[model samples]
Target: MSVKNKVAIAGVGSSRVGKVPDRTGLGLAAEAAKRAVEDAGIGWDEIDGLLTAYSMTEKYFMLGSVMCEYLGVRPKYAASMVVGGATPGVMLNHAAMAIAAGECSTVLIVIGENRKTGQTRDEAVAALTTVGHPNFENPYGPPMPALYGLVAQRHMYEFGTTSEHLASVAVTARYHASLNPEAQMRTPITVDDVLDSKMIAEPLHLLDCCLISDAAGAIIVTSAERARQLTTSPVYLRGISEFHTHEHVSMAGDLTHTGAEVSGRAAYEMAGVVPGDFDMAMLYDCFTIVPLIELEELGFVARGEAGEFFAEGRARLGGQLPVNTHGGMLSHAHAGAAGGLFDIIEASRQLRGECGERQVNGAELAVVHVEGGVLSSHCTLVLSNSR
Candidate 1:
């Protein structure tokens, strides 16, 4: 059964992002959860279900139970979900389904990590590459940047997407971050600056990569009927869908054409809205090319034209459709799995008109899309303030 308008986000919260060496992953999660409960005007005891994304920096095996013990919360339903970067979106889907199935109500979703301060630079890089195929991709010793670089290179070759177009994405993200007080990198950058930045992987500059950060984010979801009693500005889950293409980049069927094509179509169909129905978007920006490719795959822009769409200032604030209004992973904090959770939080805040300087005007609808494991898994969510 379609979950359209059945589940609604009642509240959202996030911890101090960027670098925080003092707090543990569980500590961050607790802080964010408390804030979320407060934002929803509900007591901690009201949360019957809890869902958390697995922590890569932390060594805890049963992170869900560990977090429950740490927070003094005895949830009837709990789980530690792992789907790479797609965990947050996937978890949201599961939360909605569980609530619909009468398993529990008032679910709290949280994720956090201290990757920036907890791990050495080498360790951080190594963690990203561990997802590579053990036999074929791992033997080559390619880091995450190299994997995304290959995708960027392929897009350029096939669609005439230029380096300047990639730089535009970074520049836009930085500009948005400048308006976000919680963003990691707030300094506005130029396309030339991105072009001149040190190269990590060929054709992909350091600016093209997302930041490693220590951060946490949380969201509270409940049945739509219950959401109205909790908050007047509830963001309803209008559409949600997920698609898995492969585990590794090498196994992907097509480099440019991602599973977003299928997932986006399904989500739109479920929501009964097209791409034009969205007032804003929160496309995952793990790399510069990701959102550009997603825009095409999600039908936001014509294929082979996303590069121009971004380069022409159409994706920025006051443009046709503002994207990544909270700076996104490119300039915002990206704390492992929490990076995608931040996307959902930002979209909810935008719909609620809570964003101070970076708010999208009259944002009634938003589309949030995230991919994991070298674009191997995809999930798309369409959120709205109205039913």
Candidate 2:
């Protein structure tokens, strides 16, 4: 029997994914959690396993216990996942196998963070290393921008990529975000505006970085048979993969390339599809450089061709493969940079014909990529309109 026993994402739900001072982390989770259950046509008591990312927050709360108290169901399998941003995508894969193995009937996966009202962008980056190793990279006091800047510099040097190309990614994503009212940064910007923006680090401008906002998102997944009985448009889980280059950005394997090179290949091989086969894609855009690097690694373009690839306006709106149509983390807000879930949710919306204006026409197949920890880890997922 295949471990991938034909699982499907029955429902996906998210709370207001922006800076809202009205709710706590648990409150946000509850908002998203209720919508997901309603979307799935299930109840709180139906979920057997409760999977959450970062159960221990700065406030130090237990996710499983908290969720149980809020939802009023003590789960059979309850634990917090700490695999960084890749936790949600990878843990979703784990949830599929668990259901196939008859270990659980229904699974709930959630990622929520309250950074907007709590900490500023600079303040959030400072706390990342408290749980990381301080012996080597942390002591340098290098923030995520510095680590990601290293990759941007290498790409510019290797692929002849320009600062203008990076600015284009920012400019376009913000345009899409303007179409999304739920996005944190809804203002539209131009490439010229991005180029003129203030510099955070060398080759990384203020517009190049994703926004830090407070929000939460959740999804309800069940067995394929159950999904068929529940929803008319049961979006299938085609393939999933995860990879890590290194914990600390300083010791990364390659500056120009990323672990997405490996993880992307794994996703294609497992899903039985090529990069060109995808109708749409959601490349994680924590920084402008991430999607550029991932595009090359995923074979959408050549290794040194991402610059030209992006410059052609091919990845923008009405392009061949319109990417991050819901604005992505660039304009969508990065809740601990796990904002990648919004990408996944948007893709699902496009596939299900929910996104009215930003929807890609006939989006039968799509990809959602989420990353966290400054290029240290990534999760790649392929979703298709049914088998």
Candidate 3:
């Protein structure tokens, strides 16, 4: 009778992840949607709901409606979400709620962008700077890295975390990416390489930051009843939670403590599971320090201890918790909000035992967490192969 077990991710799809200058945002989205529809084994017209995020390269009045029309499917419900990296997880929660509320049966969530190929470096930086407050933060001309840099600086100052600790996180992500053929950065890197990389912001080197790529991904959310009838591998949505703390990093109550603290606990409580119950995790790694902070907030490790955890190899594959096995945004392809959806896609694949070399053996339960807008908005999800 629980709605948690009632909704399942029936299918997921992603276009070629790395830079593709020829592909438009809409083209990538269409390709991913087609694959998701085929993977779900559902007719396009059968979809009753559609959800999407805005594209960095393309602007539209109603993106979800535009996407539905572009895909040749009209749905009873359509919505566009914008919450930076947390958009995908938020859309999934909304999709599940729409199904549980009887507003829609099958919901399709899609997002993508040509961030790498669509805009020049200056344009991309300018677009990203818009996330800052125009009145206060934007006047200072601080980019996203500067915002995250502030957090990293504070974390190090308060927790005594060192540059070496941050470098280990980048090393781990690149190592995992080496196993994933579809990953944008596949070459393995070491802590020394991470430290030697050009410094973007204080305490954050080039390797500490995530990649910018052209990518698109789609997901199918349907009732468990429908999912059972369609595919043998159905990843159930066990729990989900979303929260917004502040619009700008300057307005945040505490730079070190993100909304993940509240949302992660809410999601785990809803799913009737704890941190240890998850076999794998797909954390939004916009920066190396992000996963460290998020893992601490999620109670995967004690606060002020994530740096040591990474340094000790606790977050790597075959360790206590394998995080961002698909390399995450740090090593994987990040294309606007769609980059976050890739975390869910990878979690679904892990639960289904679809990841060949990167697969965590017997990974039945997984966690996908993403935060957006200078860690202002947060979303956490718990998924399991078993209901």
TM-score of each: 0.99, 0.94, 0.98
lDDT of 2 by residue, 1-387 (tens): 333427888888888867778877777778888888899999787898877777333365676566666667677876666666667777777888788888898888777777777665566766754544578767766676777888899889887889989988887788788888778888788888888989987899999998877788888888888998989988788888888777766577788677787878887777888988988889888889888887888889888777666677888767888889989888987775347767777888888989877878888889777766667787788888777
- When summed lDDT is taken over every stretch of 10 residues in candidate 3, the lowest stretch is 1-10
Task: Look at candidate 1 and tell me the lDDT of residue 121.
Answer: 87
TM-score of predicted structure 3: 0.98
2 versus 3: better TM-score goes to: 3
What local distance difference test score does each model get?
Answer: 0.92, 0.79, 0.91
- The residue-level lDDT of candidate 1 at 68 comes to 83
lDDT of 1 by residue, 1-387 (tens): 799999999999999988898888888888888899899999989999999988878899999898888888899999998888899999999999999999999899999898888899888877877778899999998988999999999999999999999999989999999999999999999999998999999899989989988999999999999999999899999999999989888988889999999999999999999999899989999999999999999999888899999999999999988889889999998988899999999999999999988988889999999988888889999999999
| RMSD of every prediction | 0.8, 2.0, 1.1
Query: Which candidate comes out best when scored by lDDT?
Result: 1
Scored by Cα lDDT, where does model 1 land? 0.92
- Global Cα lDDT for candidate 2: 0.79
Ranking by lDDT: 1, 3, 2
Off by over 4 Å in 2: 1-5, 55-58, 120-122, 128-133
